[model samples]
Target: MSFKEASKQRGLYLATVARNLRLSPHFVRLTVQGEDLERLPRHGYDQWFRLCLPTGDGPVDLNALPDQFGLAGYLKFKSSGLAQRVAVRNYTVRQHRPEVGEVDIDFVAHGDRGVAGPWAQRAQVGDQLALIDQGRGFSPAGESDFQLLVGDESAQPAILGILRDLPRAAQGLALIEVPEAADAQPVEAPEGFEVRWIDRSQSPARPGQAALAELRGLSLPDPPAVSAYLAGEQALVTGGRRHLVAAGWPKSKIEFVGYWRAGGAT
Candidate 1:
């Protein structure tokens, strides 16, 4: 399309669900498809997406989605709007393969309490999702002497993405504080990098908890520059970012994302 048309594009694209995958006992994968993915961005650790799915009855329908007041489309969709509108959840863009117009998002399943979690638990072929326009990347830019990535399942997808994109010679350390050993998934990283999974499945990840404490005690090598990216619960992000800054990582170099706030909207 012309640059004008592309530049005018607003809001996220509406992508239909192609399939679902149960990555592990605790997580699910929603594979979505759309033509908008043709010129998708190659965002590493910084990418995020909103996961919107049907909340009501049988075969999913796109015309039924809530959209701006357009009488014609409304008549077409509402008449057959058999699905109930539910909540919209945010998830990381784990992998986007534009070659096939498909993208994969990993969801942590915690039962019906979470809308997307349980929905994905029973997602079928041809399911529909109103995917919003893509979000900006989360990967650290420029050169860094050393970097750090930390989070739980909430951060795994982005963590894995970051690790996958890191140069094979890149140097860094990953302290993936996850729920138990089962939550620890195999990740690809540089030879000099070390990955440590802190098991805490028995309880929710608390603020200034075990992982943060451990991180504080460790000594890091000083270099020309260092950066860190953190995503997960709010308190952790706040404290983790503060600690890293105090530890010498330039605040500007740290990208801490509070994926979800505790007891409030994500």
Candidate 2:
């Protein structure tokens, strides 16, 4: 299904933080667990959700949250006065273990910047939050010879999740950009898939520039037989899409999302 169609089917799940780990200098992983998570669907590739995080020391009003974050639901949430106390943001599921009722989410924590990132950095066991599953974004509906995945640090979890869940025989190339080389994580991609990590710290370019440059330099297969997923910074998403389209790729074969804009709160 398309991302919008997938988002229409939703349910609110309340979970408590079980563990917090600093995976890298800029990455923090939060594992949340609850009985509600048992009902969460395993959509695999780039599965995301709207996360409701408490902004104050006060207890969160879980009942105030909507089952889905559509326009009507967002209006209801804002009218409930919960918007002022809760920060809602979209995040990708890094891992989910239904047997143990746990979901892992990775945040790009850069000190006290951003609502969810800082919250995750200081999140403790028992800290509460709510999630509304919006399903997966990467859907290879048509026949494709190979896949092309590209993103920056913010989209790392999603890209990695896609790689992990891809078929063992799938062949593709993933260009992932990160702030530092240390932020690169180990991937278990198919033998035919090449996962390239672009370290931004090694160059003076912006967050997604290095990856975009790499993308522009690649000799891609026939556009009609290639499925591409581009995400991360706003510039990268739009720029990558434009580049792909100009290179003879059909718009239908490319899936893109701007996870966040540079110089803006995520």
Candidate 3:
């Protein structure tokens, strides 16, 4: 489903931290559990949600959260005083196990920097939170046969999830940028897909710059037969979209989202 349609979905799923693992120098994997998770839809590719984390010491009033975070709901949530106590962020599902009522989310840990990252780094087992499913965003054109995925660390989980769920015969190229080579994670992409890991530690450019550079130099398939997904840093998403469009990619075949900006909080 499109993100817009997903936003209309109504429900609040409360969960507790089940497991937290340091996947890499910059990545943390958190597994959360809730009986309500079994009822959450599994759309697979790039499935995301609004995570409501209690940041205040006061008792959490998860009931104050709106069913869907539309404009009206957001205003209601803000006026409820819940917004001040809760830190909400959008995150992608790394994996979901309905049988166990658990979902895994990956966070880019930067040593106490940013809201969700620090919280995730120190999150203890049984910690409480709420999630409002926002569904998947990767929708390839029906006639497209080739896929091009580009993103930095912030979009790693989403891009990897998309790669994993792609058809076995899918042909594509994924350009992923990380702080260091060690930050790269193993991905289960189709045999025909090529995954390129760009290390930012070796360069002086910003987070998504290297990936965008690689994207610019690559020789891609016919634009009409290709589906491109660009995300992560704002410049990369907008710049990549502009480049792809200028290179003849059909606007309808490209799906992009700026997960975060380089100089600002997500």
Candidate 4:
């Protein structure tokens, strides 16, 4: 949890799937709606939450969610046999339209191997879901000369959201890796901000490999200060940070996060 604990705007919100759309062969967009979402705080950049969904064909009581937020609260609920019937996962808030009381979540559908991916693949409009707001991770103090963003598939939504919120005068570079070329989408960015999309459609390497390889080969600007945001597989985040530091970037300027592990990609 790279998120700030004190910054969490905790709340148990009930959301029903309003629609599901496939953005690519590996991306599914789910629109969830509820009046409770109207009250959800907008932290913008990399805002995420913990989702509670029905698990393993078992009956679930949406109201059975833990009364508290954080690890202890989740563990308490899990100890009571709720873990079997409840599926928990953390997801980024891709879009939040408070006026419509709707939040859009983009899921990386890798296949039927994982709980969340399968659920998103076949989710219906009326399917019920629960979530606890955990707030965001990207909070810069506006001191950097430029920014650097790098991530694999899982971090796409977060990186995209960050790009959306950046000022028009911002200058930076964003490297986003996807499983296939079809997964790449047009992203809005400042004129000086280079958004590079790395396609690993023919690579035998796993997710995050392409991004890491690209970062190693990239030539960064000679700026006074740079803010780097690295996310996705553990290796990618750590490896990317190491590469940056070796290239003269300050350790304090980089925000590295392992959003998921390669072993769990299936």
**Clash counts for all predictions:** 5, 0, 0, 0
Position 244, candidate 2: lDDT:
93
Question: Which residue runs does candidate 4 get wrong by more than 4 Å?
Answer: 1-9, 56-59, 141-144, 222-224
Error of 2 at 238 (Å): 0.5
**What is candidate 4's CA lDDT for residue 166?**
79
lDDT of each: 0.67, 0.89, 0.89, 0.84
- Candidate 4 per-residue lDDT, tens place, 7-69, comes to 335678899999999999899999999998998888888888888888767457777677456
lDDT of 3 by residue, 196-230 (tens): 99999999598899999999998877867788899
What lDDT, from 0 to 1, does candidate 2 have? 0.89
> Which residue segments of model 2 deviate by more than 4 Å?
141-144
Please give the lDDT score at residue 43 for candidate 3: 86
Candidate 2 lands at a TM-score of 0.96
Q: Please list the residue runs of candidate 3 whose C-alpha ends up more than 4 Å from where it truly belongs after superposition.
A: none
Q: How many backbone clashes does candidate 4 have?
A: 0
RMSD of 2: 1.3
Question: Counting only residues 3 or more apart in sequence or on different chains, how many pairs clash (N, Cα, C under 3 Å) in candidate 1?
Answer: 5
The TM-scores of all predictions, comma-separated, are 0.78, 0.96, 0.96, 0.92
